[model samples]
Target: MANTFQLEILASDRPFYVGAAEQLVFPTVDGLMGILPGHESMVTIVSPGELKYLVDGEWHYAAISEGFAEVRRDYVLVLGDAIELPEEIDAKRAAEAAERAKERLLHKQSIMQYYHSQAALNRAMNRLKISKRHNHEI
Candidate 1:
């Protein structure tokens, strides 16, 4: 049997997940990272993207935004600005948001506004992608 480690994912105001996982995959600033039990301990910034893990003989996934994870030998703690399950994403809403962001990007705006719009666009795209994949899964 694979060794299990505690995985605790924290959102802004709530605990998202608290359970045992055999492995974890999260988006880091550098790229995607996978962690296993007895892995090296480290802390890194996580980007907005899909975070997945294997647990209880199945795979679980979450959309995480602007988070960082602390990986330890027997535990991984993730704190994020936002986190949501694929099922929680409303595809229509996300599509609308993506359209809005795209429109905003096409026009002239302050640097901050442009960045914000780009970020929104990225988030919406990721949510849409995750939702699509989830829907196809039986």
Candidate 2:
């Protein structure tokens, strides 16, 4: 049998997801990072991107916004600003949001505002991208 360990994804509001995984991937502020059992302990900031994991030989995906993640020997914990499982994303809604974000940028939003909107657009696009791969109806 393969080694199994607990994985958890949390949002500031609450615990978002908890399960078992053999490997996990998340977008870190520095870049994308992958975690596995016996990974070195560390903490890092997360960026807007897809979080992927392998559970019982099946792959799972989530769209995560900015936050933090911690890795330890037996578990990987993600605390995201926002998180959405593939099944929870609506492609049409995301596309609309992306368009709105582009408009916001074009209208000369502040730097912070631009980053925020850009992050939103990235999150929505990532959600739509990952969700579609799972045979989800767009």
Candidate 3:
């Protein structure tokens, strides 16, 4: 059996997951990053995208918003702005949010507002894509 490591995924509002995982893969500012048991310790910026983890030989997926991740030799801690199982995502809501964000971007706004809207759009689109992809399996 593959070696396992402790993994704890935390959302801003609540705990998302906590258990042993054989492997973990998540989007990072640079790109997709994978971690396994005894990974080197480091911290990195997590991008808004799909996060996957292997547990008991099964792969689990979740949509996660931007945040940070801390990797240790035997443990990995993820702190995300938001995180949701594919089934938990509401496609309609996500689409609506994406539209709203797009509209906001079209209008004149401060730099901060523009950046916020862009981030919101990215998160909403990512959630929508993940939701759609997993809807058939659910």
- Largest TM-score belongs to which candidate? 3
* Best of the candidates, lDDT: 3
Instruction: Report the lDDT tens digits of candidate 1 across residue range 1-138.
Output: 578999999999799999899989999878899999998999999999999999877999988889799999999999999898989888899999999999999999999999999999999999898888887752
Instruction: Report the candidate with higher TM-score, 2 versus 3.
Output: 3
lDDT of 3 by residue, 36-120 (tens): 9999999999999999999999999999998999999999999999999999998889999999999999999999999999999
- Per-residue lDDT of 9-113 in model 2, one digit per residue for the tens? 897777877888899988876788988889999989888888888888988888888888888999888898778877877878988988887788787768999
Q: In the order shown, what is each candidate's alpha-carbon RMSD? A: 1.6, 1.9, 1.3
**Whole-structure CA lDDT of model 3:** 0.95
Q: Which stretches of candidate 3 lie over 4 Å from their true place?
A: none
lDDT-better candidate, 1 vs 2 = 1
Ranking by TM-score: 3, 1, 2
Worst 10 residues of 1 by lDDT: 129-138
What's the alpha carbon RMSD for model 3? 1.3
Q: After superposition, how far is residue 111 of candidate 3 from its true place, in Å?
A: 1.4
Pairs clashing within candidate 1: none
